[model samples]
Target: MLKAVILIGGPQKGTRFRPLSFEVPKPLFPVAGVPMIQHHIEACAQVPGMQEILLIGFYQPDEPLTQFLEAAQQEFNLPVRYLQEFAPLGTGGGLYHFRDQILAGSPEAFFVLNADVCSDFPLSAMLEAHRRQRHPFLLLGTTANRTQSLNYGCIVENPQTHEVLHYVEKPSTFISDIINCGIYLFSPEALKPLRDVFQRNQQDGQLEDSPGLWPGAGTIRLEQDVFSALAGQGQIYVHLTDGIWSQIKSAGSALYASRLYLSRYQDTHPERLAKHTPGGPWIRGNVYIHPTAKVAPSAVLGPNVSIGKGVTVGEGVRLRESIVLHGATLQEHTCVLHSIVGWGSTVGRWARVEVPPVTLTPTIPEPAWTVRASSRTGSCCLLSPSWAAESGSLPRCSS
Candidate 1:
């Protein structure tokens, strides 16, 4: 049997995805017409012998998350569960803390995925590689440009053997072009190193009493403490993939990741992609519209657009490269381009919600347009044109 663990950090994390994270947890945020982690669950479920999937995070099992778990269990026919941490535990800490739960079924190996990433999840490929070598650690790696690589965990691997020779997490200087994709396949023996890190942290915590120190005794950074330490020991290996992969660090990246997944729908879930039909909304490319969404026939949505549940698209509205969230309304002739329309938000007639469209590239600095919902009312109204160019900050919405 095999299992999968998804590490979805708590509210304290994903600070970069503000306003949206304010309305819904980052993991629960919709991407490609479903909660972000649903894609992870779907991918995990497809792997043969996959018994169960566990989600480890510090969120208090709120209503939305609870519903998602229940729905996933029903849909996947597997025991999809959420293991909440007492406090904020580091990536490795959660795995170590819940070791027994993961190892209970004697899984041959379990896939560990960071919930913040979007990928075509080459789980089966990694599993095949793991079965061949039986390595303790198998990391999913992908190439990045030199300048963008510094932001991720870089890996140095033997070209011939594919063994990880050195590892660095977000180093000050460029280390390697191959960056860790935050997707890992590990055998049961992998828990030993995590335990070692936990015990060492406990010992160090006892010796030093610095209140300012972060990542207390229980916190274990999987990248720094495990991958970096185990490199060159013949225990860690890399499985390079030239597939759809991107880190959903900010809302801008979320939009970019949405486009990636929407494009992927053609291969994985073609039925999910909207088809241009007689008297139906004119869809240019890959578009996912919920069944309940009421879209006008003249509304043109395409190329990469996700219309969520109960959304209303008015006549002649043009939506491209955007996500119109649940219950959002685009009034007649409104144009939404390269933006995210918040839940229950309304863009009045003839409004243009857009930003200067940057050519989508594999790099991380692309501009983003966001329509932030009102924290007080849970909705906003865009009466006039709104533009956002920066990826790091949320734009002010006119209520």
Candidate 2:
């Protein structure tokens, strides 16, 4: 049997995804009509012989997360569990801390995924590669633009062998176009290196105070500590992919990822995309409207938009590349673009909410093709009662 482990960093990690993250855990936030990590769960469930999925993070098992787990367990029919770390254990530390549980049934191999990423999740290909030669670590690699590559864990590999020759995490200088996709397939033997890191940290703790004194000791950053330490040792390899992949670090990027996923639904979940009915909201491109939402026939929603539970779109309303969250009501002819309408928020008649679109650049959280937006995005956030007025000038907000 095989299993998968998702490293969902706690509340403290996704600071970039504010406001929305304030409402739901970043992983739980909706992307393409479903919670962000739901995509991950769906992808893992499709892999043959996948038995269990473990989510490792410091977030207390809150209601949303618990609900997601319960629902996912039923839907996937697998033991989907959450392993809460007592403290923030860097990416690798949680794996080491929960080593026993992971190795319990003696899984042939378990995949490790960073919760922030959005990808097509080519797991079976990695499995085939691992089976051909059981490498200790198999990292999914994808190419990024040369300038953007520096912001990620860069890898240089032997073309024929696919052996990771050198690894550097977020190097100041360019290393290679291929970067770690934050998705890894690790054989059971990979735990040995983690144990080694744990012991070394334990010994080093003796010199200081106690491992307990610091916030995290075994807090191994998988990129720097292990991949970098053992690259070219014949244990690490890369499986390059040209699949749909991006990181959801900010609201704008979330919007971007929604578009990507909505596009994918055409092939993988056509039913989720709303269709234009004889007397219903006219959908343009890819759109998802919850069954409970009420949209007027004259309203237009399209390209990339997700209307959540109980949302009411008034006549002539126009929504594009945005999410009308649960309970939000858009009065007659209101227009929302490149923005997210907060839950239960109301946009009065003729009001327009907008964010001037700009090319997304590589930055924090990760070099995600999307961006949290800089001052340009941060400056536009406006939630004033005055915004409801019928002003030709739109009220700007961060996407």
Candidate 3:
């Protein structure tokens, strides 16, 4: 029997996300009507022999994750366990920290994945590859593209054995087309190295030194540090996959993944995107506008938009290439494109929230701007209606 564990890198509320991260933890954000991490969980659950799923992260350790788990259970119907890391552990560290819980089945092999990846790789095939090689571990590999894999690490494998030869960090040059896909199947022995690292850290009174601890306090970035170090020691393997794969890292990446997810869903469930608005809004192909949502008569929605349940779209509103989370309100005459609106958030009336408006209609525009708040609470926002002649700074709103 084989089991799997998923390590959702904790609350993404750092400087990188800023204002957007303030309203909700990054993992909780909607990636095509579903939470980003939940997508990984649902995908993992589909893999043969994945009986249980575990989410480890450094959050309040209770509230937020619990709520997410409840919603996940309701949506996915898979049993999930939320493990709170008292200490922030890196990827490898977090797994090792919860080793006992993960290895409960004492299975021959287990699966592990990064929370931020969106892929259609066949997990069962990877498992078969692991069994065929009879190696200690198997790392999923994707064909590298110019845009990606430059910043990501490479998977150097023995061409004949398919065993991971070495794991190298972003080398700044075109190294290999096979890049680490942030997914893996590990034999029991593969975890031995992690155990050794943990013991080493315990002796030094440092969880990071332990190598199996969380990120902030632990030296646990698998690609940046752990896997690279382990590769030098020679115990890892790689399994190449021929499938769609993308890293949902930054805001830009998030938007791209959302569109991709919608497109994929439309492939299997076309009716899910069907809206009976008659002549209300201009919903584009593959958009998901929830039935519980109320779109005003004078609004224009979609090209790729996901309006969550109970969301209220005001009259004269124009939303394209955006996601409106559950219970959020879009005031009258607002134009929101290329952005994500959090749950229960209220956009002021006649506001313009986009990267930036352009002088031409069909030309490329700018990066969407948000209120810059120095504190954790978030920054003050402003709304500029398209009908208005001028833009003005608006008041600050709390999450």
Q: Which candidate number would show the highest TM-score if scored against the true structure?
A: 1
lDDT of 1 by residue, 239-339 (tens): 99999999998767888999999999989899999999999999999999999999999999988999999999999989999888898888777788887
TM-score of 3: 0.79
How well does each candidate superpose onto the true structure, as a TM-score? Answer: 0.92, 0.89, 0.79
Instruction: Mark the regions of model 3 whose C-alpha exceeds 4 Å error after superposition.
Output: 12-14, 172-174, 202-221, 224-226, 232-234, 268-271, 276-280, 342-352, 356-399
Evaluate all candidate structures by whole-model CA lDDT and list the values in order.
Answer: 0.87, 0.84, 0.68
What lDDT does candidate 2 reach at residue 185? 99
For model 1 the local lDDT of residue 219 reads 79
RMSD of 3: 6.8
Query: Which 10-residue window of candidate 3 scores lowest in summed lDDT?
Result: 386-395
**Per-residue alpha-carbon lDDT of candidate 3 for residues 1-399, written as tens digits (9 for 90 to 100):** 677677676664244443445556777767777778877777777776666778777766456667888877776666788887776667777777777887787877878887777777468888887777676667888776655556678877778766565677787876677788788888877777777666665566763334534323344566755577777345677777776677776555666677777887866457667464676765656678777988887788776678888999988888887778788888776667776676677776656566543321111222445532121244444543321111212222333
Ranking by TM-score: 1, 2, 3
lDDT of 2 by residue, 277-342 (tens): 898889899999999999999999997999999999999989998877788888877778777777
Q: Which candidate leads the pack in lDDT?
A: 1
User: lDDT of candidate 3?
Assistant: 0.68
Candidate with better TM-score, 2 vs 3: 2
